[model samples]
Target chain A: MNRLNGTLLRTSLRRRSFSTADNVDGNLQGSKVQIFDRHLKRKQRDRAAWLINRKDSLVNTVADNLLDRLEDVKKTFPTTLCLGGSLEAIRRSVRGRGAIQKLIMMDSSYDMVKLCKDAEKDLASDNIETSFMVGDEEYLPIQASSVDLVISCLGLHWTNDLPGAMIQSRLALKPDGLFLAAIFGGETLKELRIACTIAHMEREGGVSPRISPLAQVRDAGNLLTRAGFTLPGVDVDEYQVRYNSALELIEHLRAMGETNALVNRIKFLKKDTALATAAVYESMFAAEDGTIPATFQVIYMTGWREHESQQKAKRRGSATVSFQDIQKEFGAGETT
Target chain B: MVRANRVVEISKTLSEILVCPLSKQPLRVCEKSNSLISDAIGVSFPIVDGIPCLVPKDGKIIEAEVSRDGDSANTKRRYHQDGTGGS
Candidate 1:
């Protein structure tokens, strides 16, 4: 019985560590060490879905910020693919806008996908059709040149190969199709990360990867260009949300289905370590009001599939005015 | 928390855009089974609550007989009024 139990535990532990990317790309199998375990993430998100209908404060806010960029576009998209934008948030916002006609919503979690039923009801008289799909964005599963627009909000951070995912999305777009995304990047949850690091070290004399690394802001533009997207653009934005305490922030992360799912992540924090983490967070970042602030950095990536109708840059030497005349012609006030 | 072999009823409009996650080939409904079949991939994907579960690792759901007047009746009503790009 003892031997059987040990085998069972080892098997379960090994299964739990299986990551998503290796299966998506066979070449990466047995060679690369990936961080996020996609199945564990799905299970985590699935379990979280049962507890709350939770249109998360940070997720909805960032989604709204991402969608607001659509108004600047002159034309509407006939078929738009939304990967992991919160259903309740996006459905209500798109009711009046002509931005999308047929929206394909995809997520890795079936529970999250099921939430679409309740979300769609709020779109009464909106005259839009949506198809919800359960998929890991790494595989994408979209046909080349199928969609008019592909947008993702705060979803790609967990992807094992973000660059490969971006390339797949680019290939899935129709010519001149737009790809716009907002990913949590650049120093998100810095305070919590620091607090957890300190607490773990003090309690256990060592640290494990408590938080997953995110994409850097400086690399955003190059990622798009590497994916062969045309007219790429990248921008950064930050939002601050105040939690009564660090424990409350952790609770919010759970509610948001944003718990750490890194493959090598410590399974659970010790009770004393948890208390220490909260205390450390309070000392370092608490405001006069006794609330702690969590900062989220959003990186927005925009690009387009190459098309004949899209604008193009002129030849290198074709400019009428030279750079040497910048001071004389356009430098002061009369350049216009 | 996920159950095995679940059948979800969905709309005809939704069937149009769904392609096999493995092959990216258009999927067809096996009217007898009500599962989305991809001939190219030779695998049937399961749907839960109108959302097609495309990931293969979670495994296929148990076959359940879904009727037009059943769980998907709600979706059919909305599809009739709002479905665009329908054949």
Candidate 2:
């Protein structure tokens, strides 16, 4: 048994080394950058304040959609893990569903976890078991193949190692367990991205990364497959939120804890450049009402760990009927 | 008494399941050291305000803290300073 355990550990370490190599190569190509600070205390501080004043409509919408999908599954997920700080939203949605027996709430920032715990206090009851942990999504601290379901909303986009995080999520789940997540996709903040780029180039002769590079909706399915998930499904939900001006949009982003935290981000935006960006934003994207539209394209994904009970594709040569026979039966004719 | 028992139960469950991020080996929660020790990796991760500071960037700080004041002594000092009985 000891020898077997040693071998298993060695195999796991070897697999991790390969993923680490891919991560390094991705960084060099600028396709995957370590932009967000791994230590998310700054983000937590901003987000806590935001949650207190206003409702997180975007995340709440995503949470509602996730719950709707979970309802269709028609199975009680006895052990559920809620990733990120949107515990209250999830807890409310999952309540009375009788789906979760034990729920583990985890977040990268300690402050976010504290906020979740505080929120839990008001809703405490003896029916369902719940706990909180400060843990990063990329490097989840949970044991492998122990969880029944893992859900993350509006958080996976900030990860530097998104594919690694997905792989870790899969590893944390038991066979046939579900992984559901929503992230801001490539079209998010399109107007702001353009304005910021032009403003920086005109003023500083160069542009720094002001917005995070979000995963494209087209690539979500591929990412899930690459992470060893089966029956991967990816879809998009677009929302157009109108702001009085670009400045308000920027303020909204800050409150959402979505401000630029890239390591290579400019320390400060020049006063002149900031004004220019706002001007450009208004000129290009403003509506007749003097409000500018910010596009938020949310990409939702669902994947399940491979299990024998799940459907499988037929063997290549196992079909009873041939394609040529079907065509002949339909009286196929070639015409130009 | 019930609350105290619940706290102990939670701590025990956490210690049983938590493992070293690097080595993936089970971590021993040394109540005397106030840290989680990974015997395979020979590294200790400090617990701050009851939350484990397990991020790799904080490893150096944990090492320094452990070496500066021996584990048991530091734990004792903290318990006395905070005026809270040891866990």
Candidate 3:
């Protein structure tokens, strides 16, 4: 009995140690990790579907603008990483650019990763070597202060651990490394959020279908600074597309692989309630234009990691001020 | 008192739930060395107090996944068996 108990104890200790070990790497792969993975999977599937069905016209239209930004990015950093980027789009942008060395491409779904890899093989871009990893925005598997530049497009806003992801991105960057990303703004899916909320309130009187969260420009910039990045810059642009119907907008969103995979997605949507909601969505369409507006909030951000030695000095200076000095400043009781 | 910068070995379940902030991968607690190892990056972090200083500035890098796999089932069963003490 004693031997058995010892064995049990040893096993318990080892498992406990393993879990604790993850903390060292800072992965946070528990419940929150699942939430992020689910979110990315849903979004990617929806978006990819939209792009394929639409004949790639829309994606190609945006290619030039995206390519222009990539050109500027290449000049800024020697190494770059693109998170949740489709292979075709990234290849088109970075074609003929020789400044970048290694480009780490990360996404959550295996299907998307495979799709991206297949597309990359066809491109034959020899200058930039690609490393594909199955990961989410929240739990990135990369070294700290190693990557020279980090760029994510249309992905970070959907992450459950936005702040955590931002912090990790900052840590992954070397001092003066550039971080660039484009995400949906508050205006994204505005009509959908409004219609869902109104329908829910009218029927059972509650919140609407959970929409993917998007970051505000100010908030995105603040996140960069909070994550230990310096010289943070953020710009938001609103691009409105006229959709023939509300359902079309949702369908496009779905095809683009953007879906609501929030951990708190309503477990059950009553069939009757859902039908009523759909009707409500249809009712709101403009009679004249026969179009619903889908807004894309594109955010461009650039920041550099602050060198560790500079930070250490600041901390040391603060420490030298002493607890008693702080207490005095707070106007506490006089020192003895 | 659990003071900052003091190394403390954590329970197994919490470790599974906790992740390295940088790599977002699983971490292994090296209690003997008072460090946490990132298999993907081959970095080990020292713990201070009950908290692990996962920050790269403070930790050292070691071999990868030396103690992560081949030990899940036994750990889970022990957790259920240990009653109040296992977490």
Candidate 4:
């Protein structure tokens, strides 16, 4: 019995190390070592029916919001580079807009590029010329300062070098060119994370990594600044998606190619542990309507390249009015 | 086969804009061999199913003798003479 206990303890400790290593590093950001397998991602994307079913709803919603923002811009963009090729909804939104001349859809996954190419045939029109290419976000093949606009939706979060990719994007844009993107934020899948950790600890006496680290809302603004963008804006929007059970949510995630892809992730989970995790998730986050609620936090960011025509900040200490004078003038006025 | 043709068709425009991921030098398409040759690095990236495999590991480096400056001119002439290029 003692020997068995010792073995179990060693196994548990080994499992715990995988999840705790990132905390030891004191940062959740990915380093030079790639955590995601681009080949696996491509294979997953090859299942056309699965991608269409799992991603259509969320992609459509996000695309609509992005389109509304694009419509607000006064200037027209002639050439646009889209990072992710799974952009059917965005294609539809940009269609019939005479302002856009060329749309270059790029993705690291071959299947994704192929899918977009097939879809491009249907979108063929005189207004916008569309093309697809298989290209990595980190090593963009675009020429410097060539594109008028750059847009990415639900794609950049998978990149190991997010900051580098952003810098490449900034360099790809023309002067004063616009950059807009949306990615999953830190708060995404919080309920599932909690449930999985608790279930793993209870079942195996320790926990392993089950979710990828996501960027925080605060990190978005800082990243844009580091990437040399002007007038950067970052905001978060929370989406609550209800599912029949926790297992159903997992299925949707798998179909969307959002499964755990951490390089240090445990290769497999025991059947009992998985079932226990589902039970815990349902018990913890289920609503009165007998469905579990999963939160998806989307972070939206927008920035522009430096241009002579754009507005500039006033010089420091340039204000003529003193604070004391304003206070004195307002202090005598009575409150209504 | 159709997908491969589509990729080649797209490459006509893309080859002009894309560069070597490592050397950042302009890429030249070898139509006979269906590869993108980077003279700076002497690495040829294969065009698989119409999509150019620009990933570093997928590229083939030319032999040392062919890559050397002394024999590069002769190697280029030989490469153009024979249709086969990459390993």
Which candidate has the top score in DockQ?
A: 1
**Docking quality band of candidate 4, CAPRI definitions:** acceptable
- Please write out the lDDT profile of model 3 over residues A108-212, one tens digit for every residue: 554555566567767765677665544556656456666777877666766655666787787777776777776777677676776677777888877733675
The true-versus-predicted C-alpha distance at residue B18 of model 2, in Å, is 3.4
Model 3 lDDT at residue A332: 75
The complex in candidate 3 yields a DockQ of: 0.06
Candidates 3 and 4: which is better by TM-score?
4
Candidate 2 DockQ, CA atoms: 0.27
Q: What is the DockQ of each candidate?
A: 0.40, 0.27, 0.06, 0.38
- Clash count, one per candidate: 2, 0, 35, 0
TM-score to true structure, per model: 0.78, 0.78, 0.62, 0.80
Clashing pairs in 4: none
Off by over 4 Å in 4: A1-33, A47-50, A124-126, A315-336, B1-8, B11-13, B68-87
- Name model 3 segments beyond 4 Å from true: A1-67, A73-76, A85-88, A124-126, A307-336, B1-87
Cand. 3 TM to true fold:
0.62
Which is the better candidate, 1 or 3, if ranked by DockQ? Answer: 1
lDDT of 1 by residue, A87-108 (tens): 4566666654645878888888
Q: What TM-score number comes out for model 2?
A: 0.78
User: Regarding lDDT, does 3 or 4 come out ahead?
Assistant: 4
After TM-score superposition, the amount by which residue A166's alpha carbon in candidate 4 deviates from its true location, in angstroms, is 0.3
CA error at residue A38 for candidate 4, angstroms: 4.1
lDDT of 4 by residue, B1-87 (tens): 764564456444466567776666888887667788888889888776666767566679867437446776777767776967653
